[model samples]
Target: MVDYIDQHRERFGVEPICRILRRAGIQIAPSSYYAAKTRPPSPRAVADQQRLEMIRRVHVDNYGVYGVRKMHAELNRRGHRIARCTVHRLMRGDGLRGVS
Candidate 1:
Protein backbone atom coordinates (compact mmCIF):
# COMPACT_ATOMS: atom_id res chain seq x y z
CA MET A 1 0.00 0.00 0.00
CA VAL A 2 2.78 2.41 0.92
CA ASP A 3 4.76 1.43 -2.14
CA TYR A 4 1.74 2.05 -4.37
CA ILE A 5 1.23 5.51 -2.89
CA ASP A 6 4.91 6.34 -3.17
CA GLN A 7 5.15 5.12 -6.75
CA HIS A 8 2.43 7.47 -7.92
CA ARG A 9 2.88 10.37 -5.54
CA GLU A 10 5.08 12.27 -8.01
CA ARG A 11 3.27 11.47 -11.27
CA PHE A 12 -0.17 12.03 -9.78
CA GLY A 13 -1.14 14.33 -6.97
CA VAL A 14 -2.42 12.80 -3.77
CA GLU A 15 -6.07 13.02 -4.78
CA PRO A 16 -5.55 11.34 -8.11
CA ILE A 17 -3.25 8.79 -6.57
CA CYS A 18 -5.79 7.87 -3.97
CA ARG A 19 -8.47 7.67 -6.61
CA ILE A 20 -6.40 5.31 -8.70
CA LEU A 21 -5.54 3.23 -5.66
CA ARG A 22 -9.18 3.01 -4.65
CA ARG A 23 -10.15 1.95 -8.13
CA ALA A 24 -7.45 -0.71 -7.99
CA GLY A 25 -8.84 -2.21 -4.76
CA ILE A 26 -6.56 -0.33 -2.39
CA GLN A 27 -8.15 1.05 0.80
CA ILE A 28 -6.35 4.38 1.00
CA ALA A 29 -8.40 7.55 0.79
CA PRO A 30 -7.51 11.04 -0.35
CA SER A 31 -8.27 12.31 3.10
CA SER A 32 -5.64 9.97 4.50
CA TYR A 33 -2.94 11.49 2.35
CA TYR A 34 -4.19 14.97 3.10
CA ALA A 35 -4.12 14.22 6.79
CA ALA A 36 -0.66 12.76 6.53
CA LYS A 37 0.63 15.81 4.70
CA THR A 38 -0.93 18.25 7.14
CA ARG A 39 0.12 16.35 10.24
CA PRO A 40 3.00 17.59 12.35
CA PRO A 41 6.36 15.94 11.86
CA SER A 42 7.26 12.95 13.98
CA PRO A 43 9.33 13.24 17.13
CA ARG A 44 12.38 11.87 15.37
CA ALA A 45 12.18 14.60 12.75
CA VAL A 46 11.94 17.32 15.38
CA ALA A 47 14.85 15.83 17.28
CA ASP A 48 16.89 15.62 14.11
CA GLN A 49 16.28 19.29 13.41
CA GLN A 50 17.40 20.23 16.89
CA ARG A 51 20.45 18.01 16.63
CA LEU A 52 21.35 19.46 13.25
CA GLU A 53 21.10 22.95 14.69
CA MET A 54 23.46 21.96 17.47
CA ILE A 55 25.89 20.50 14.96
CA ARG A 56 25.83 23.72 12.96
CA ARG A 57 26.41 25.79 16.06
CA VAL A 58 29.30 23.64 17.16
CA HIS A 59 30.88 23.81 13.74
CA VAL A 60 30.54 27.58 13.45
CA ASP A 61 31.39 28.22 17.09
CA ASN A 62 34.69 26.45 16.54
CA TYR A 63 35.28 28.34 13.29
CA GLY A 64 34.32 25.21 11.30
CA VAL A 65 37.11 23.22 12.91
CA TYR A 66 34.86 20.37 14.03
CA GLY A 67 34.53 17.35 11.78
CA VAL A 68 32.04 14.50 12.01
CA ARG A 69 33.79 12.39 14.67
CA LYS A 70 34.34 15.28 17.07
CA MET A 71 30.95 16.70 16.31
CA HIS A 72 29.35 13.32 16.92
CA ALA A 73 31.12 12.96 20.28
CA GLU A 74 30.20 16.49 21.29
CA LEU A 75 26.56 16.01 20.34
CA ASN A 76 26.48 12.75 22.24
CA ARG A 77 27.96 14.42 25.28
CA ARG A 78 25.26 17.07 25.03
CA GLY A 79 22.58 14.31 24.95
CA HIS A 80 21.54 14.63 21.32
CA ARG A 81 21.37 10.82 20.68
CA ILE A 82 22.66 10.94 17.10
CA ALA A 83 24.98 8.85 14.97
CA ARG A 84 28.36 9.91 13.62
CA CYS A 85 27.14 9.38 10.07
CA THR A 86 24.18 11.63 10.76
CA VAL A 87 26.56 14.29 11.99
CA HIS A 88 28.65 13.78 8.87
CA ARG A 89 25.62 14.14 6.65
CA LEU A 90 24.43 17.31 8.38
CA MET A 91 27.88 18.85 8.36
CA ARG A 92 28.33 17.94 4.71
CA GLY A 93 24.97 19.50 3.89
CA ASP A 94 25.99 22.70 5.67
CA GLY A 95 29.40 22.77 3.88
CA LEU A 96 31.32 22.62 7.16
CA ARG A 97 34.69 20.93 7.45
CA GLY A 98 37.65 20.52 9.73
CA VAL A 99 40.41 23.12 9.68
CA SER A 100 42.96 20.48 8.56
Candidate 2:
Protein backbone atom coordinates (compact mmCIF):
# COMPACT_ATOMS: atom_id res chain seq x y z
CA MET A 1 0.00 0.00 0.00
CA VAL A 2 3.02 2.26 0.31
CA ASP A 3 3.34 2.38 -3.48
CA TYR A 4 -0.37 3.06 -3.84
CA ILE A 5 -0.25 5.78 -1.21
CA ASP A 6 2.75 7.36 -2.97
CA GLN A 7 1.00 7.39 -6.33
CA HIS A 8 -2.39 8.66 -5.16
CA ARG A 9 -1.60 10.81 -2.12
CA GLU A 10 -2.21 13.99 -4.15
CA ARG A 11 -5.72 12.78 -4.92
CA PHE A 12 -6.80 10.64 -1.94
CA GLY A 13 -4.35 11.86 0.72
CA VAL A 14 -1.92 9.80 2.83
CA GLU A 15 -3.78 9.62 6.17
CA PRO A 16 -7.06 8.75 4.45
CA ILE A 17 -5.41 5.91 2.54
CA CYS A 18 -3.72 4.64 5.66
CA ARG A 19 -7.06 4.72 7.48
CA ILE A 20 -8.71 2.69 4.74
CA LEU A 21 -5.88 0.17 4.86
CA ARG A 22 -6.19 -0.09 8.62
CA ARG A 23 -9.87 -0.98 8.29
CA ALA A 24 -8.81 -3.81 5.99
CA GLY A 25 -6.28 -5.09 8.59
CA ILE A 26 -3.28 -3.74 6.73
CA GLN A 27 -2.22 -1.23 9.30
CA ILE A 28 0.64 1.15 8.58
CA ALA A 29 1.71 4.47 10.02
CA PRO A 30 2.83 7.07 7.47
CA SER A 31 6.08 7.54 9.35
CA SER A 32 6.76 3.84 9.24
CA TYR A 33 6.16 3.75 5.50
CA TYR A 34 8.47 6.68 4.86
CA ALA A 35 11.15 5.25 7.12
CA ALA A 36 11.01 1.87 5.40
CA LYS A 37 11.27 3.59 2.01
CA THR A 38 14.44 5.43 3.02
CA ARG A 39 16.25 2.82 5.10
CA PRO A 40 18.80 0.43 3.56
CA PRO A 41 18.26 -3.33 3.76
CA SER A 42 19.15 -4.97 7.09
CA PRO A 43 22.14 -7.23 7.66
CA ARG A 44 19.93 -10.37 7.58
CA ALA A 45 18.59 -9.36 4.17
CA VAL A 46 22.15 -8.85 2.86
CA ALA A 47 23.22 -12.22 4.23
CA ASP A 48 20.18 -13.91 2.66
CA GLN A 49 21.01 -12.40 -0.72
CA GLN A 50 24.60 -13.60 -0.53
CA ARG A 51 23.54 -17.09 0.53
CA LEU A 52 20.89 -17.20 -2.20
CA GLU A 53 23.48 -16.44 -4.86
CA MET A 54 25.72 -19.18 -3.57
CA ILE A 55 22.79 -21.60 -3.45
CA ARG A 56 21.86 -20.82 -7.04
CA ARG A 57 25.41 -21.44 -8.18
CA VAL A 58 25.45 -24.80 -6.38
CA HIS A 59 22.09 -25.77 -7.87
CA VAL A 60 23.28 -24.97 -11.38
CA ASP A 61 26.68 -26.63 -10.94
CA ASN A 62 25.10 -29.86 -9.77
CA TYR A 63 22.83 -30.03 -12.86
CA GLY A 64 19.84 -29.08 -10.67
CA VAL A 65 19.16 -32.68 -9.69
CA TYR A 66 19.90 -32.55 -5.98
CA GLY A 67 17.18 -32.05 -3.37
CA VAL A 68 17.53 -30.13 -0.09
CA ARG A 69 19.46 -32.92 1.68
CA LYS A 70 22.11 -33.27 -1.02
CA MET A 71 22.18 -29.54 -1.61
CA HIS A 72 23.05 -28.97 2.05
CA ALA A 73 25.66 -31.71 1.92
CA GLU A 74 27.27 -30.25 -1.19
CA LEU A 75 27.35 -26.76 0.30
CA ASN A 76 28.89 -28.14 3.50
CA ARG A 77 31.43 -30.16 1.50
CA ARG A 78 32.49 -26.94 -0.16
CA GLY A 79 33.18 -25.50 3.34
CA HIS A 80 30.08 -23.30 3.45
CA ARG A 81 28.95 -24.47 6.97
CA ILE A 82 25.33 -23.53 6.14
CA ALA A 83 22.27 -25.21 7.62
CA ARG A 84 20.16 -27.76 5.72
CA CYS A 85 16.93 -25.98 6.59
CA THR A 86 18.32 -22.69 5.29
CA VAL A 87 19.18 -24.32 1.98
CA HIS A 88 15.70 -25.83 1.79
CA ARG A 89 14.06 -22.53 2.70
CA LEU A 90 16.00 -20.64 0.05
CA MET A 91 15.32 -23.28 -2.58
CA ARG A 92 11.58 -23.22 -1.89
CA GLY A 93 11.51 -19.42 -1.89
CA ASP A 94 13.29 -19.33 -5.28
CA GLY A 95 10.93 -21.96 -6.78
CA LEU A 96 13.74 -24.46 -7.20
CA ARG A 97 12.92 -28.18 -7.28
CA GLY A 98 14.97 -31.35 -7.47
CA VAL A 99 14.63 -33.87 -10.36
CA SER A 100 12.99 -36.36 -7.97
Alpha carbon lDDT of each predicted model: 0.79, 0.88
Runs in model 1 lying further than 4 Å from the true structure: 1-33, 77-81
Model 2 misplaced stretches (Cα beyond 4 Å): 1-14
| Per-prediction TM-score | 0.56, 0.82
Instruction: Single out the weakest 10-residue window by summed lDDT for candidate 2.
Output: 29-38
The digit string of per-residue lDDT tens for model 1 on 25-99 reads: 988887776677678989978977887788888778778787788888887887878888888877787777887
Tell me, by TM-score, which candidate is best: 2
RMSD of candidate 2 to the truth, in angstroms, is 2.6
lDDT of 2 by residue, 1-100 (tens): 6788899899988888888889999989888778877999999889889999998999999899988999899889999988888888899999888997
